[model samples]
Target: MGIITGVIGHWGWEVEDYLLDVWEAHRTPIILATSSILICVWLYLYFSEEREGLVALPRQYTVETKRTSPFQLSNPLPTTKPKVVGEKATTVGPKRIRGEIPRQTTQKESPKRDGLEIQVLVFYSSLTGKTEKAVKDLVEVSQEEINGAGTGTCRFPDAQILDLSEIDYDEYFINPPKREDGKAVDYFYLLLLPSYNIDTINDTFLEHLKETHNDFRIDSAPLSNLVGYSVFGFGDREGWPTEEDGYGFQAKEVDRWMAKLTGRKRAFPLGLGDLKMDGKARLLEWSSGLIDVLRMFAQTGVLGDGVRGSGDADESDGEYASDEEEDTETSIEGNEKPTKNKGSIDDVEDLGKMVAPSEKAPLAIDFTTYGKSKPVNIQTPQAKEMVPKTSPTYAALTKQGYSIIGSHSGVKICRWTKSALRGRGSCYKYSFYGINSHQCMESTPSLSCSNKCVFCWRHGTNPVGTIWRWQVDPPDLIFSGIKEAHYKKIKMMRGVPGVRAERFQEAMRIRHCALSLVGEPIFYPHINEFVGMLHAERISTFLVCNAQHPDQLAALKPITQLYVSIDAADKESLRRIDRPLHRDFWERFQRCLEILREKRFKQRTVFRLTLVKGFNIDEAVKGYADLVDKALPCFVEIKGVTYCGTSTSSSAGLTMANVPFYAEIQEFVEALNHELNSRGLEYGIAAEHAHSCCALLASARFKKNGKWHTRIDYDRFFDLWEERGPDGDWTPEDYMGEETPEWATWGNGGFDPRDTRVDRKGRKIEV
Candidate 1:
């Protein structure tokens, strides 16, 4: 080893020098060749690893083993652990690392079942707890009725009652709830809603339904999954005496919304009840009807014949059609049979031999007469009854509280009559005229009308015709029938709470007749005779016409007052507002105005202008003033349109927004009065009924000394009518009553002082 060390020491310097020279010369080439070789080795290693199915570990998963000590014992654990059997393995991949592991699909498959079990959900909204109590009673009654229905293919479980104020709208309204146990189940919704003028949960629920229907992201009818639905509403009749006055308004709105949401699956017509009077009875009746409908659905799975399913909104409880008549008409149209000859041919002698026997002869034409002569002994077609008992029109009118009289006439107890009986107040007629509301009989001789006004509270249920073509009932029969019906309806109100004993007794005897119940009173062929019949009984007559029938308006009748409905001030506006059926409606209206001008001295002429906000209120002052100047009526009654919660109105784009507020009405009235006065028209704002949103403008002729004399003297009117026949000359001043009441005058509110005003909850409202 020493000899080798001495030799290496001697050659070390020479070997180091030789190596340094070789390194300096080949440095560049050596670096290039090494890089190339390293690259080729790396490519070959990568390809070999790929072929062996090896993958580079991600940075996050790269394990760095730190050796605490080089001498530390080698870990005994294997790098790859064996998977345990029956254990849910953790997902380990790009998807898992990116947090995108697939989730179970939300799309659920409907379970197939043998039969449908109907689950009835009774929903209610109450403000004063009255509806809550009613709902409890209804649920109990419904449960009993369903239990009594016996077992069948469709089984009904216990009914569920839900308070609308507490329920989540999205859970039920957006789509029907899914059964957790996966059974074929159908749901029926029954809503009991109490209307309140003030804010309530009902408004919020209604808004949700509207938004859901209008939402673009959802189907327009999301609740179409529901089998059926119905609604019953409770309201205070004393505060809101009519549907047009917001009685049961919320319930109606709910029914309408449900109809839309359920694709017109209104299983039953809406039932409205007066909370203080027939609320329970109506609820029971509605429930009974609903139980019948449920049975029908279970047995047939169809809403019976004549029942509107997925169609128009139901406006009445009953619907009927004359199948026999329809079949006959269809047969006649299909057969095309030749009409029988009315008379013998005049030229029969010329073709005596050629003519066959009379019985076997073909329909012969009379050459001499040709088409110039009318057919002799040709029986005229029989006139049809205006409102048949089995007709839809009759059912609709009865449902709306009208008692039909004769075939063509009807009599109804006005809301004002009920209010007056309950000492709530009277209609605007009572404020302008001295007619006792409870003692007034509101009747119409003809139920057929000429116009379908947009503000018609009847919801297009009343029949419309351009002419009187129905069978005419005798005037005497109509008069008596109307009186009996009126008295009967009034007597039915005897058990109603808050009815004054004296007022109830006074209502038994009719002191006046209001011919403005529904239709154009002048349309009755025997209107004059009918008025005479009322006058004979000392009942003052206030006949209102649509002003479309000029001949009837001009023909004759002197009564307490004559009203011509001036719905619009211009022709185009009239067409839009009145929707008159007559082709020459404007001419007829102008002629009626001229007739009124001519009859101003003979009868108490009035122009009743129903102001619909957007349709006729804007820029209509001067036009109305011109009409007044042309007619020179004794008084002009201006009233805001009453909003009827009807599909017809909704389709016409009319809503609560179109309803003018009392303040807005006052502004319009004031503006109209200014316009009239500026045109030298001696008309003044004589009185106002703020409660009814009505204002009266009287002519100077009604002004006695310094006070306006607008109120009519019923006794004096009858006296004048009896002393001088209807055709006799008479003036409006002849039967003028005392000066207008102080409380009824302009700016005094026009509410009777004796009656107390109450809020919707029956709390006395201090004026």
Candidate 2:
């Protein structure tokens, strides 16, 4: 054993020496390889484990579940056991795993698949209950019509009337409502809304519609599923005459919003009715039209070709096209044809033909040469009628309740006249100048004017010209025609509700003539002859003229009273307010004031100031005072501008905000009174008609013995005119009447005691 151990030990020592040499040579490479392998293993393990953790995290934290229904209650019953005092706690019912509560599935019945039935939902908002009643009537009529239609594949159920104030907007407006009975049905929405300046449910409903259309989280046209929609509005034309003036404003807003929500599915044009005038007739027409459309839809499942409801084309496109065609046709003379390009001599000749006169029409006469130049029979182009029967202006005027008499004259029953017939009230003239409103005739001899006032109630439809260039109608024909038309209008009012029997009879006899119905009355060349016709019939005339016509004002004969409208204080303001066509309008206005100053003693001259809040009310006191200083008139009638609610007024930037309130008018009158007094002008506040937002400032000449003598004795004035003729040497003082009534004085309300004050619904208002 010792020998074997010795041999092994010797071998081991030899092997160790060889191995040590080998380790020293390869130890560095082996260490580097081992370190690189450890790093690779660590990186693989770290990244793979992280990936595995991420993949497993959702499984641990979240449980797969169905989507919760929007109508489902979000709150679930508690599952945890409650500990009772002095009692052993036990697990309640079943313990729910956290984040593992099973979603209670609410299987809402899907909307019925059948599309053969139509469900019409009539919605309305009423302030004074008129619209509500109107809706009821409309629904009844619609149901009858639908019943009359024979049963077919597409049947109409009874229309449901829903008050907008009572219904949940989300149930219907957010999206078309599904029938609770799970019946497949299509919906047609109809809205009848009354407009009010005051806040009402219509405002809230309109706001919701607007917000729904603009919401980003929901579909913009969520209600596009609706079959169709229509809106009708009721308004008072006497107070709010046009849409631009806020007449049926809320209805317009609803129509606009519904058009957006329904993907431009306006089933009908927005229908508007004046509540006091044509509400029932207009509503019946709209309802009939809607019923016809509904029947058509049921039969064909389409709104029909070229129907407005089927698309979003502009309503005015056809009219605009027609106007363009007319313009093109009128530019070409006689039988001449228009060329696309004017490069040829033939085209040039065609253009020259445009200036030539037609042989068929009579040559225009030069009336200005009657006195100065010799009368020459020139071959000028024939003059067109001031307002032809077929013209759009004539149509527009007729629509606004005016009876166009002959070619140039128009007559209409003023609101004040209607009020007096109803025994509600009279005009400011009744309180200030002793004129009976019931016996007054408001007519205009000329339908053309020189200026386009922003507040013109004509809706900018009246013809405007720098000079008279149309066929002139004789004064007698105008006189007889206007009286006949005026009488006819008065006779129609006899059957109206609230028209007094005695007043109705009295209204037949025209006692006074107000020449300020519309347009510049003095624009008529035979204005003096017209005045003579009125005076001959013992009718007192009140002639109102725009200050643009100085020459006409100078030539005007004596009348009961002369009024010159002073709309603005200076040239720039005048341009903005009057929008006169004549470049020398300011010069003409100044000259008219000079002429008025001369006629102050001979006639009862006055300055009428219509104060538009934003345009002419502020810082214009001194300017108006300067005008008063220039005119030196007998009276200064100040009134707030009446908003005419038209697109033209809106385009001119005039809004309801531009109309001054009665308080503002009062403040303006006070300021003017102070300014006039400061200028040594003996003018005092003579009267006020608060209902009309008008105040009168008169010269001291009209005040006698501590009372105002502003009222004119009409009989005495007529007698004086007949005795001394139009150029009589009599002064205004000779015809001044008794003292002004106490109720019409500066502080009094100016409402006649005999007439009962009434609200819009004709209910008596307690004093």
Against the true structure, candidate 2 reaches a TM-score of 0.53
Q: Kindly list the per-residue Cα lDDT of model 1 for residues 1-767, writing each as its tens digit.
A: 99999999989989999989999999999999999999999999976764465333443333223211111112122244222223322222222111111111111111221355778899998877888998898788679777554245667888999998888899999878878997657788989888888887988998998898778677676776576787888889899865556887888778767766765556665777876898787777778767866776665554432223311211221121112211010001111221221222111011122223552222222222212333233223666777788765554455445678888888877767877876678888788887789999888888778787877765444666665556778999998898887765664453233444446556778998889887778878778888887788888888889887777777867878889999998999999988877777788889899999999998899999998889999989989989999999999999998874555577666788888888988998889899888988888999999989999999999998889999887777777777877777678888888999989999999998877776544457777
TM agreement with the true structure for every prediction: 0.52, 0.53
Model 1: residues with Cα > 4 Å off, grouped in runs: 1-379
Error of 2 at 641 (Å): 0.7
Candidate 2 regions off by >4 Å? 1-381
Give the C-alpha miss distance for residue 672 in model 1, angstroms.
Answer: 1.3
**How many backbone clashes does every candidate have?**
0, 1
